[model samples]
Target: MRLAMGFALITLFCSNSYADGYKLHPGTPTFQGKHFDIDIQEHCQEGEVTCPDVSYDSINKKTGARLHLKGRVMFNPNNYNFQGYIFDNGDYSYVLNPNHSKGTESVQIWNLNVFYKDKVIAFDEGIMQ
Candidate 1:
């Protein structure tokens, strides 16, 4: 009985560790523009995103206070495909995909944004107007 109990506890602990290994630091900043918050994620060349290099910030629109986190992504002129997420304090999240794909006729780019209030509002692909 003692051995069985010990084994069970060990198994439980090990499984939990492997369940979800990725952790985002809780240092997310807050923005005060109409009382809003924003989150941004950008993907560049591999092995480029690093701490004190790939972070976000909150800018006060009225006061023009640039409160931001320092972060940077690897740059490759040949490759233009990138993907990431942005969470806005207005209860919304955005998925940003800035890429240009060569095609037979024309190139294509995908951009999306989601807003949550009483319902979900989706912003689809389109030229910035």
Candidate 2:
């Protein structure tokens, strides 16, 4: 009985250690698509027209499990402007912008997470749709 109790205690302690070792960073967005995994960090202005910084990481040609890094996105209500950056984890990051600006449209926004097959493929500053 003592041996069994000892084993159980050891197992519980080890499992607890794993849980505490890598707590996912809060505000760390995650996206999972059909062929990619993207993680990003984003910052945005509340109830105002402003651009937030975004950092991204992704894996292409992914068959099973990958990672992506992306940057933040900015939105403008005055001119309906939108722009942002995405980190590809190699070389240069990509930039995105809305085609047109729609002024003072009562915009709503949020950080986004795209998931596919129970895995993260993308992380975006929540949508302002």
Candidate 3:
């Protein structure tokens, strides 16, 4: 029983330690489509765990209107799922599936969901080094 428990603990530890945790850089990356032009910034802090801070400045390119949002994303290490919020409230949120972001030593490919009032307004994807 003790051996099994020890193995389980080690497995959990290794998963957390080895998994590629989120990192945000100083450069803001933007994603533009036919309707939206969105700039995203990840405010990654040293020793940050679970929730990483993020913000967005998005423009409806057609109308020249804008939306600026600030919040954090809660990441599930087990499945690579993420839940994000706008305005620091649960009332506004979006979910990002497995394909949103992928990280390696050299770069991170981010396909983030931009949310406003429980709706996904835009998708911002780019490479950050």
Candidate 4:
């Protein structure tokens, strides 16, 4: 019942979201993790027109470091079943991979791996709904 209400609120918040790019106001639907808390909003770009890209604001709980990584809704053939909302910068990356569809949630599971050069420095998984 609670999950359904959450999904309903998610639906209400996400309805008609792409008219001027993805705009998640105030970040109610957030990725809650132990070491990181991430939220997303519409990526504001310079120019006359609005961008359809999305940006993630991630905060490291331990160090209080924040990252404003920008990316878009990527569609990969291999990851067709998942939400390919992915971001990468040099050796650092944030990928929102899928777990399994419990119902109709877009961001149900998260898989993030922070890389330092070639090795992964941190890995965290959490729920987003």
Candidate 5:
């Protein structure tokens, strides 16, 4: 019960941030995970805040296996749902969660548990964007 509440709070803080800061269109990350690091690149209309057609680039930190994927920026304004990016690439489903900090530094958190086909692939974090 306590853990659930804590997770809920964390989710609220992370997802509460607006997309105004993190504009994808060829977005890049300084660090990559052991398995891969996801990027929010291209497929956004000019002058639009949210995008439906989004592209993602991933590269394995160890083997350097780059995974190119495509997804969309989705959300439910009426229901206050996950306002982030998602990819449905067959067996590998990805939710590029918007985990940003709302402090003076004002950066995005890249804590990820990368999994491929129900197998633990790698872990990624320590990204400020």
Candidate 6:
């Protein structure tokens, strides 16, 4: 009985920790046949006040070139749900959950942007408008 209780406690703790991590799974979008795999994680570091880390990874399908992007993101105090990132590349930025008209519509669309060289490489969840 004691072992079972311990296991239950451990499970709860793990789930709680995971709940604090907000992740966005950007759908696969290829550029010039070079597939981009993105894994965006917004989680707090050991000494960070909140989830200030915004990072992503991309792998080239043809040449196997992997690009890892790291950025510092800020959270809005009035709206804790909104966050944005500016990557170390200096030309790239990603805004998460931007305020949009569609967001208030029935569909509840989520807006995510990927910029390169100050130009938007990819934007919006579905079709770009």
lDDT of 6 by residue, 1-129 (tens): 999999999988776566433222345332212133345554566545345466756444333456667766666677554454455566667544434665454444445566787677876453121
Best by lDDT: 4
How many backbone clashes can be found in candidate 3? 0
TM-score of structure candidate 5: 0.55
Question: Which candidate do you rate higher for TM-score, 2 or 3?
Answer: 3
Cα distance off (Å), candidate 5, residue 67:
0.2
- Clashing residue pairs in candidate 5 (N, C-alpha, C atoms within 3 angstroms): 26-42
Q: What is the TM-score of each predicted model, taking all chains together?
A: 0.28, 0.32, 0.42, 0.55, 0.55, 0.41
| lDDT string, candidate 2, 32-114, tens digits | 33333345555555644454556565443223224445455555557855554434334443433332343245542333344
Residue-level lDDT tens digits of model 4 in 1-23 = 99999999887666534322433
23-114 per-residue lDDT for model 1 (tens digits): 22345422211322334443445555331234554333233344334344333446733343344444544333343452223433434455
Model 1: lDDT to the true structure: 0.42
Residues 49-80, model 5: lDDT tens digits:
45768877765544445567787776776864
Tens-place lDDT per residue, model 3, 12-125, is 877655432311223443553344455656687754544457776655544556667776666667875554333444555533323344657665454556467757876655
lDDT of 3: 0.53
* Model 3 quality (TM-score): 0.42
Local distance difference test values of all predictions, in order: 0.42, 0.46, 0.53, 0.64, 0.59, 0.52
Q: In order, what is each prediction's RMSD in angstroms?
A: 17.5, 10.9, 19.5, 14.6, 15.4, 16.0
State residue 111's C-alpha deviation in candidate 1, in Å: 2.1
Local error of candidate 6 at 80, Å? 3.6
